[model samples]
Target: MPVTPQPLGRRERNKQEKLDRITAAATELFAQYGVDDVTTQQIADKADIGTGTLFLYARNKGELLLLVQNAHYAEALERGRAEAETIPNVLGAVMAIVRPIVECNRVQVDNGRFYLREMVFGDPAEPHHGQALSIVARTEEAIAAALGRHGPIATGDAATTARIISAVMFVTMAASVNASLTTAAILQDIEAQVSLLARR
Candidate 1:
């Protein structure tokens, strides 16, 4: 008879199990009830863990929400960067970045909704806003680089134009999420928006 492989250590296995449970419960609850309506106790119950155990992983609801958003956003950004590399045209690059985010917003609508709530109501003095702003700045830089190479935009105004385009993209994304617009619709609208910006 083949010997059975030893199982994972209790502590390591239990910790992984708890994390999985917590994430699964959070995804389901936030999806169904909206993040604002879901409670830590509810999440804990859904995970079949005590509320206290839940706190061992997350300090509070806000932190848990931030964690969830960060995970999703990181994945989306990676995909955006990959798509950006493939597109040769500046407009194509910008659209690649925006399209992934819109898709993520649609797929993770609840988490997207929760992120919007935090952006509105969370401590305005918090550093998360600064971090998010930095991301926008980096995106603007990428657009500027892509556009500066071709006869895309005036060299002197490339940065400004990129920033303007970034602002338009974000506002459009927010509007799309608010209106529950599909990603395809968002991309279609973006083509018109970018065309107007190209003339600037």
Candidate 2:
């Protein structure tokens, strides 16, 4: 059996609550008003925290975007897993595990820009960067699990195959964003890649 982890201390839990409040407020504001138009003071006000206190969690609006986007990405990954379970084919399964996140980015394109920038180049020491990597890893695992259900090509060596598939998914998403392509086009490209990969 897996070991149960220890619980966070009271102080740590309180800190997490504060972070959650700020992220939730930021998500609402960013979604409703767009990231560029939303101010840090507005976020602080929505969170019911002092301006200075909000700064303690995130240095500025960009970092605040990271916090909010991380939460959004995590939720998307969970949704992807549940959705993936209903699909029967590897390509469709992979799409089920990735489409939610792609659509989330599409819905929040402005923040998606900043979020992708940070994901590629932000300081790995930062909390959000680390958290984002963990979320991506989990997503990769989900993709791998779906592939495992369909073919020996993936299940024969799950870890490396998963990473490769995840990389392909990320590349498809990045290309879609950079080229301003429709989601249908992006999924078509992904299907092509997975079809080729599945045959190998």
- Cα displacement (angstroms), candidate 1, residue 36, comes to 3.9
The regions of model 2 sitting more than 4 angstroms off are 1-17, 154-156, 176-179
Query: What local distance difference test score does each model get?
Result: 0.71, 0.81
Give the least accurate 10-residue stretch of model 1, judged by summed lDDT.
124-133
TM-scores of the candidates are: 0.69, 0.80
**Could you give candidate 2's per-residue lDDT for residues 38-133 as a string of tens digits?**
999999999999999999898878788888888778999999899889988877888888788877776766677667767777888888888878
RMSD of 1: 6.3
Cα lDDT tens digits, model 1, 1-200, are 99999989999899999988998888788778777789999999999999999988776676567545655665676677677777877678767766776676667565675565565566645555444445556777766766676454776688888888777766666664455776687678876888677655
